[model samples]
Target: MQIMRPLYVDPAVPGMAFTYVMATGGGVAQADRYRQDLVCGPGTQALFTTQAATKVYRMEHDYATQRVHLTAGEGAYVEYLPDAVIPFAGSRFHQSSVVTADETATVVYAETVTGGRLARGERHEYTVFTSDLEIRRPDGTLLAVDTMRLRPEDVGGVTGPGVFAGHDHVASVHVVSTRRPAQEIADTLHRSLADADVLHGTSVLPEACGAWTRILGHEQPCVTAAVHTAWDAVRRLLLGHPAPDLRKQ
Candidate 1:
């Protein structure tokens, strides 16, 4: 694994700082394991993101795994947005991210998944793909959990009415903030993507901590744009500001 020093970016919200550039040393390979831990102190704000898309190469041996642990202290704010993950044929991979934060803390997290290398006509050819995300309060009370265990062969097909529904890319975003109303945030995001070329849904999370959104689109760019729309709405609803361009080259 590789990690670059965090740089302060201009935050849309005053007093909130942002940073970047943590990534895997090399493309993920069979039998590889990666672990990352981040902590945000009280009243601090920061952002974390990967340098590029995570590519899972073909595997003839064991699978690869990545685990992330994050902690946000009282009144802290954090945003974790990683690029999409693309798995090649015969690849097996698993990744999980868990966050523990105080009730007053806020977090915005997102994940994107592509069917495969679309240019190569590869879609849902991976052996196994599993992912899990969880959020908990400081007392260890579970707030939300999102899990996906996908096996194309066993599922008959990865894209269908019940599955991805013919979409080549899928994205999800979660907003956790005690300061705002969850239903309001959900409504805002639902309306934001109503006319988009993507299929999406938004709902409030358990305990009313915040809201969550899932979007599916046939094209990578459309799906990514839809996800960003939801993220932007969340920022506006919670921070009372517009989203800033990440300026990711």
Candidate 2:
């Protein structure tokens, strides 16, 4: 639970501040519980990301859970794009995130999960992994909801047709904004992945709030690149500029 001072690292969007969240412990352990809350003031531009990938160690007893809440004020633009989460064998983890955005604000959120430590041949060896995401207006009206529950021991398993579909990594990006038409946003997202070597899909969010995309790939690099492509496209479309390299080693 540590945070680094915000920096103005994006030349394209000099007004946007970049902040990095760091974990005191090396990774999550059994019986761990964590929570995070992020708020963007009116007309502020900010981007929040983790310093490194989150690792969930093997658990012998209870499970680990994380909760996150994000709020965007009027005319604010916010982005929360954390690194991927990797679960070790026999680990169990759950995460829930809720985003509240004003009618005039815009928000971009992204998340990625791996099958496990691919180098160690730990593919979906975890006991269970789950995540839930909800988007809402300031008045509490819901805009969209996404839920994922993966259990390799289940009957059909997570590698079935509609789920991960045999992919070792999966990523998702959600954009909530009024700067562009929802369909156009979806189109931009779809076109961004056109040349990427991965399987992906895009659609407009409920109530025409924005657009979202889901990507699947066998390797982490490919999946990550696709997600970045989509994010860059959305940035160009909404902010009229390309994404700046955060220079994260």
Candidate 3:
């Protein structure tokens, strides 16, 4: 089955929650499929999340796929903060998300997957797992693209220097704008990022008329927590939202 939701971007939603509920029994049968997507309109703000870790039931041959598409218009902001994804024994899954925003827009996105339920002492033993993310501006201006993958009996490539850099969880926050004084904002964020535990960095993309900040950490929750905090800082410094009312925890 397929599910989709569209919410206005203005006033952003409280706690900005996005959730999905499964009705089928445990373990997906062969050739089964599930899909979900979200869309936000101009001047709108939203945050997307799922109730709990998604499970990929065992599949020996074919892999399941999930595709998400988002649209944010001018002066809008959205965050994709879904819960963890869990792949069960011998299962395979492919995940991809693509987004395009107007010039005056902001996006904070994060995705995480586990080899298996670790509490059950499961190690990395999946057939295949992957996540592909990309974003651009209204005029087809590219901002950033990331592709990550893992397989059974092989070391995951998320730890690459240009990528996750040995961190299990990966996240990226981007702001697209043509406003001047880019240097000033970049400098301030750099100073505020002092002594952060995660390997974090920020860079401005004038060609795309925006900037991007990336954070890598050992735990998924830690990476998301840091992103939430950074959002608060940016809202306070740039958007002028008070500390608590910036982005709901």
Candidate 4:
């Protein structure tokens, strides 16, 4: 496990503290388990990200698991934007992230999944890839839940009619904010992707707290670009600030 010092990169948003969690000892491997927790106090803003992409290496034994927990207090704003997650051939991995926030808190989260090392002719070769994300109020009332269980071998591969067909990368963004109109935000995000070379969609979440977006493309850059576009829209609508370049390598 690696933890790095925080940085003050955004002059326009001085109130939002940014931190990087460096993953040491290389990337995830077989039989590895990781847990992380983050808290944002009332009226404070923060951002969290990894130093690099999370690579799930090939495994010969048990699979790996990663769990993350986050808490945001009233009037707080938080964003968790990690790099892409690359699952190498013969890998099995599971990840879960849960966020508990007060009714007034706002959050933005994103994830990207690639079709393995396409240049090495690796695609849909992983044994299993599972991810679950949930958001809830401080009282434990669930506001939203998103789960993905992909087993290419059992499902006849990741590419097929109606299933990530012709797409080598996928990305998604979730924005939770009670201060903005959910449908309007969704419309704005949808418009932002009108010229992108990808297949994407957006919809408001339950109870109109916020919205979500999903995008599929043939390359990682395309999907990530779409996600960034959506994030820009969210930032403008919810935070009234422009999206800052993270400058990730």
Model 4 C-alpha lDDT per residue in residues 116-222, reported as the tens digit of each score: 87889999888899999998999999999988878898646768755678788888888888887888888888998999999998999888878888889998888
Error of 2 at 191 (Å): 0.4
Model 2 misplacement above 4 A = none
In candidate 3, what are the lDDT values of residues 7-86, reduced to their tens digit?
33325334443433332445444465655556677766566655456778778667788777777777776666666677
Evaluated against the true structure, the overall lDDT of model 2 is 0.94
Candidate 1 lDDT (Cα, 0 to 1) = 0.86
Cα error, candidate 4, residue 19 (Å): 0.9
- Best candidate (score: TM-score): 2
| Candidate 3 colliding pairs | 9-44, 9-45, 10-43, 10-44, 159-165, 159-166
Candidate 4 has an lDDT of 0.88
lDDT of 2 by residue, 1-249 (tens): 878999997877889999999999999999999999999989989999999999999999999999999999999999999999999999999999999999889999999999999998889999999999999998999999999999999999898899988899999999999989999999999999999999999999999999999999998989988888999999999999887776778
Question: Which should have the higher TM-score, number 1 or number 3?
Answer: 1
Rank by TM-score, descending?
A: 2, 4, 1, 3
Candidate 1: 10-residue stretch with minimal lDDT: 17-26
Q: Which prediction has more favorable lDDT, 3 or 4?
A: 4
Lowest lDDT sum, 10 consecutive residues, model 4, at 154-163
